[model samples]
Target: MDRRLFIKLLSQSALVSYGLLACPYLGWAKSAFDYALEGQELIQQKNFAEAIKALKESTRIDPNSDWSYGLLGRAHLGLGQKAEAVAAFREAVRLNPLDTYSRMMIEIVTQKPLPKLEKKKKPVSPLEQEAYSEEALMKSELKAEEGLEYQVKRVVIDAGHGGFDSGAVGKSGLKEKDVTLDLSLKLHEKLKADGKVKSFLTRTGDYYVPLSDRTATANQHQADLLISVHINANENKTPHGSETYFCSEKASSSEAEKVAALENSVIKFDEPYKKKAGYIDIEEILLKFEQQLYWNESGKFATTFQERFKKWLPLKSRGVHSANFYVLRMAKMPSILLETGFISNANDEEMLKKPAFREKIVNAIARGLA
Candidate 1:
């Protein structure tokens, strides 16, 4: 591929900023993550040389930081250093086998140079040009991979707010934790019985598994996908519907922001909160640049998921949204959180309380995955 194949970043609006460290945003001192963030900013400013220096410090602090390595690749790509970019991207994919973004970049770079494209009547922006190149390469790659399809053999189903965390409550006294567990159990069973994909559950019973552990479980299982199931709620009790969520620093809407806040409220129980929140190691920097790519892919998957999930449900489809969900922040693979219905809504709560309705929701999930 030509060095200018990708002239722009993943998305101009995607992942503008992230909580790079655990403590109080970025404190006085800097961490490797801070350097990485600086590198990202430099790249945005089109300062590839300075970006490379910052990213080098990031890798020097933690040689195993795949996301940082991937950033190094982008910086190199920005400088039109094809060999250097390939090296960085390869190291990233090596450190994290599931980094499809880096892997795809490697393939795109090493493949034969793209044929020259005719100039358009309207001048294209860097972002648009990058998109066109990616689209062309992705189509070619998809065709060669498996006719634009892949068989998902492994899946991790997470039941949100286990143990003492009674996620949400309805007027009828239904518990969100209980509902999610039941739905996840059924979804697991159905996926197993269908003989299409092997499924794993984050928690087998009512035990509080930390948010980090949930994604860690998926990584340990080497799962192809992670689906954290949760029931929605609101004080107003009016927003009653099914919506899918993928992770993003900037929430797609206010409703999405609120939903993410509600789900991420349990993070206070996690161990990371104990740290001083500054100068953390690279192993601990879960949210990386690669996450932007994964979240973008997650958004695409959420759309397809909603299309399939809404077919078997009686609830209104509220469509797909993006928010910075803690549980979704660290997933190495594409991950999504499913808000089946609002438990705060009377009709939704009533339906959620029924066994038959739970079954339908699980079936809908299975259908969505298929």
Candidate 2:
């Protein structure tokens, strides 16, 4: 079956597969407000395990509150317990069908094929919980390297596509290039304000900078890291999330390939423009396989970025993925591409338009890179 059909079947099976949290233990006295407030605070601090505990307590205290379950799902997502996340999100939707966040999150998680959750829901297995719990703990206790503090002498921010390249336009005409440019400008300004870092743009105006040129500019400057920003869209408006990608020789799955195809299409300019390309030699693609070191580092930064971003925006965290992206493949240093959000999704489009939300995203990225 096609992806849409697969997703539909997945969603239907998911709803029938998972049930509400079954509790045989005595309830706690924690209030819903207490759980939500404390959970939100812990999540802000990137303490997802503790946030899950707090949210769970809230749900135990008030089983009727869908907000608690939804928040619990967010915490589990941060911890990478996709199965538990799907369960919690499903419960949230069952409790309150009107909760869009819960519904969206459920669909996203289910699409990835999470295992059939236990009916008891009492921390499925300590081993699985421990793995994600450690991740949350490590993030909370983050420490800088001995002499490798978030040091950046030079930085390059690449706005995915521009002039003559409308990029991926949604049915509503929300162009990827426009959002990427505005977001990149915001990121540039934010990075520039950091006295320790000097920022440069591959292309500041609405002009197409060949993918090769974008990476070449960063490599020439000896950039500490390069960040390419773009927006994501899909055939179905239902899928919405923020996915970060790092370069790898491993081919992407069919879904990822579709996304890459849509994004790469932006750079297909006229022949005259193609002749001036810096990355015309296909030989360079093989060199990417040898740069596994940079790919590993880029993956680290991508993970950090997605974790920080999900705290502010309610976008689903699609995790750090690897793909043979041309923009990333040619880069000499660590490079990451951020698929901000689905511009095609009405809810996300509304959120993307807000200045406050944009600033929050920019600030999160800067902090993550720092």
Root-mean-square deviation per candidate: 14.9, 20.3
Off by over 4 Å in 2: 1-153, 270-290
- Taken over the whole model, the C-alpha lDDT of each candidate is 0.81, 0.71
User: Model 1, range 1-370, lDDT digits (tens) per residue?
Assistant: 2322232223221212223333334454555666877898998777999999999998886576677888899888877687898899888877766566677677667765433335457566766566677868877876687433334689999999989898998998999999999999888999988999999999989889999899899988878789999999999989899999999989999988999999999898888744555433333322364577678778878888899899889999999999999998889888999999999999999999889998999999998987
Model 2, residue 8: displacement in angstroms? 62
- Tens digits of per-residue lDDT for model 2, 257-342: 77767766644552333344443222232233337768877777777767777776667888777677878877878888889888
| Deviating ranges (above 4 Å) for candidate 1 | 1-150, 273-280, 283-287
Candidate 2 Cα lDDT to native? 0.71
Error of 2 at 129 (Å): 41
Q: Give every collision pair in model 2.
A: none
